[model samples]
Target chain A: MVPKLWNETIEEHRRAVREAVLETTAALVAEQGLRGVTMSRIAEESGIGRATLYKYFPDVETIMVAWHERQIAGHLAELSELRDRPGTPGERLEAVLERYALIQQQRHGHAGELSALMHSGDHVTHAEQHLRHFVRELLTEGVQTGEVRDDVSPEELAGYCLHALAGAASLPSRAAVRRLVAVTLAGLRPQG
Target chain B: MVPKLWNETIEEHRRAVREAVLETTAALVAEQGLRGVTMSRIAEESGIGRATLYKYFPDVETIMVAWHERQIAGHLAELSELRDRPGTPGERLEAVLERYALIQQQRHGHAGELSALMHSGDHVTHAEQHLRHFVRELLTEGVQTGEVRDDVSPEELAGYCLHALAGAASLPSRAAVRRLVAVTLAGLRPQG
Candidate 1:
């Protein structure tokens, strides 16, 4: 029992260190361009030793990619939690989109130098598939409730919603983001 | 009269040379990325002397920007031409979107190393304004014809359409492109 508890404590400590490294890498990338991100700097900022940082990540790009993966996972979890909230399917979708747009707007805050890195990764395809699946399921539910148009497939509508909301990332204000979301939601209504 | 004729010939030659330089730069970037594009290589590919090439453009980045400007101008001209075609406003909008999707798909072919360069520039804002204005006008016409939703403002709907169709650029096939356009058009219909 004593050995098992010691191992669990060590695992918890390791996880904490890993999370700190990711957070430090992201903050450094946000404050400086990709060029300024280095293992030593990350170690200094994260309060970890250089040797320990090297054991966890080989290079800056790898650390950034790991950080991005965590961001994507966190976002997906948030969306899923929103999706399961008690509401009509359409209302849930609206809530999810509103949250998605806000997340996109925040991501755009790091657009100048990190935008390219954000877009170029294998994780993009996986994340896209997950998002499309999530939205399509909600759309199917909305269709059954007569809240969304039935002529178009849910797959197509999912694509439309994602693409339409993508520009919200670059919008100037929260009001503009909300307006864009309204326009997108209007597009989903049953046609006359 | 003789000097006037001579000046006309000189002006025509200068225009041809400028066009050739732009084409050559684009081809080089397509084949070898932005890094391989140099004045010497451009001169060699364009069948011009180094001195003449330098006379036309000062640096590789400048030449690339000029080439990008021309591409934007060409796309705008094509869209405007489609807008003026003999058809109902709805039909014209459909035709323009189909062509725009194809253009976007073509642009994606060069997205690897040049995508950032393609997106960044003052010209992008100008092109976006032109596109939004053109699409908004068409939506207004459709609204008048009772074919489009009057609940949302034309400007808002236009933004939705552009943002939605932008994803067609990355779709896997022409069939997918058509489906995305169909979904976008469906979104514009009057809501019950």
Candidate 2:
């Protein structure tokens, strides 16, 4: 027999618990450095019981992976908006960098723990893999359109883009971040 | 009253302690994530007294800063080497990217942690600030020579570069990272 809607409601409640765990982690990470964050700490800060926290995340890494996914969704949305603007490929890419840099500057301090955690060292989550695949698709599209060079693959270029922006996000201000983004785009200019 | 070698000895001793702390924290973070790192844990792992560790780092954040500086130093060295090679601006930039991307692939696990820590919540350290300055200088030089674009500022571009590469570093392999770099560089090409 199919599970009842009440069962479905229970699943919905389960998801909310997971999301609550992630949301609470994000806020805590944004506030305290990663060291300050703990499941117990999250439990305390989130006003959820430790048992509830445990029910949602097996460990800190699982909770963080969820949190990082949330940030990635936001960033991908920004990337789509940036890339979709009407302009030359160079201008669009530059705009993406500028916009990304600005956003990063705003989110830098607030994001350190999750950014550090979503990275390697923990098990690769589906969201991390999915985001990579999505970004790779974006790069491949850039190449197929002749908007990008064919020599280097989309994956490598995506690395360069992420590495540069990670550095940018930690800078002191939007102007500084924008300058970095602009120059990096310039550096990427295709040969004569 | 001559403390001739005293300062040098003290500096050397301090350097050794600092490196020990960084190495230990790097190991701990690799095994346990940045949150796994702590002053007491580092002191225990490194076999240094808690007081000694405190004398050097005062907290987890300062030690992280030192470690990040060490990681960036590697990238900067690779870039400097690539810049010295005989090539047109386009060639050099591509070469530098190739070299740097390789370094990133090799150092991903460790350096990726440094990045994650750099992003983890609260108070930007001097090392983070310095990395931005370094990227700015590199990009400014690229722009001035017309090897890179001038329309976008160096800082904005650097932000994108950091974000792309750091994200790529978490991917499974070198081939994947290289493709992303190529596509991004390709997109930087100027329209005829």
Candidate 3:
């Protein structure tokens, strides 16, 4: 039987190896398009043996899907943290939206190939659902406070915000993204 | 040389043939998926001889592109007509937004395959530019009439409206799409 400390050490080592593999593969894909990446190159760049790399991920497509999942999780966590941060409901919503817009902006050009590959899976659907739910909850809280428009359902309002902010992917600058967030926020305000 | 009346008749026939080919190809793509379509099949279904079909379009891809371009032209003409219709600036803007949302909602499920094929190339770029310009002009008119908020530039607000209404694609009903349009229009109203 393995000792507790040894088990923990092995788990930590496994995580480190996985992290290295994911990062190396992403860097390679970025430097050379997705078509140029291969399992051998990922293992070589990651400084892991090909056999061990195979144990971690079966192939480039699998590695890419895993990497995309991790990236999406990170983004969701970042948004969740902002949502949970101390602020008025309106302020928190703005913070969450601005961050989301910036993320979209940063992904603009680089997202083409990766997005085409990564956007179709079950994981993407789940993440979108989670994101919509997250924003809906925020809008619900704001509506309770009379900060958001009460006429539109929070669910519909959340969808509007997401689709509006998605245009950030084509925006030219951070300022433009902020303006988009502002306009979206304006739409959510109480109507006179 | 052909007589003048004969020349006119020949031109009319050419136009009719082109229209038939475009419409038949679109119908075929809709019935079967893009992969199931071919030039010979298009020729057979369009009832234009293979040689004549070849004179009009060399392949399925060219035919699809031509069809998409024509469809885009029709949509633009519809929007332009709404824009030019007699109404208050606010009313006209709402009309355009509502129609655009309905179009998006209608395209949701059926758009996947066709959009993937037709969304590239210079024609799409030109159409998007025309669409943005079209909306921007409407917003500018609304702003001049003090119906639209002046805090954001008409350009930015136009982007917001287009992006927001695009959410209608995922909406489940016409009422939901109209609600989305209302929320997007709300964003354009003059601020307190």
Give the C-alpha miss distance for residue A82 in model 1, angstroms: 1.5
**Model 1 docking category:** acceptable
Runs of candidate 1 exceeding 4 Å displacement: A1-10, A33-44, A47-52, A111-117, A120-125, A143-147, A189-192, B1-18, B28-60, B120-125, B140-153
The 10-residue segment with the lowest total lDDT in model 3 chain A: A116-125
TM-score, first chain, each model: 0.88, 0.76, 0.88
Error of 1 at B94 (Å): 3.0
lDDT of each: 0.80, 0.67, 0.83
Q: Would you list the rank order by lDDT, best first?
A: 3, 1, 2
Which candidate has the top score in lDDT? 3
Fnat values, one per model, are 0.48, 0.68, 0.71
What TM-score, to 2 decimals, does candidate 1 have? 0.81
Q: Can you write out model 2's per-residue Cα lDDT over B1-192, one digit (the tens) per residue?
A: 759699889889888888888888888877887666778899999999998778777788778777877877766776777777887766776676666666666666645656654655354666556656755566676776776566666665555554555555555777776665665464444423
DockQ of each: 0.42, 0.38, 0.50
* Number of the candidate with higher TM-score, 1 or 3: 3
Q: Give residue A132's lDDT in candidate 2 (0 to 100).
A: 55
The model with the greater lDDT, 2 or 3, is 3
Q: Highest DockQ among the candidates is held by which one?
A: 3
Q: Candidate 3: where is the Cα deviation over 4 Å?
A: A1-64, A116-124, B4-17, B28-55, B58-61, B116-123
Q: Judged by TM-score, which candidate is best?
A: 3
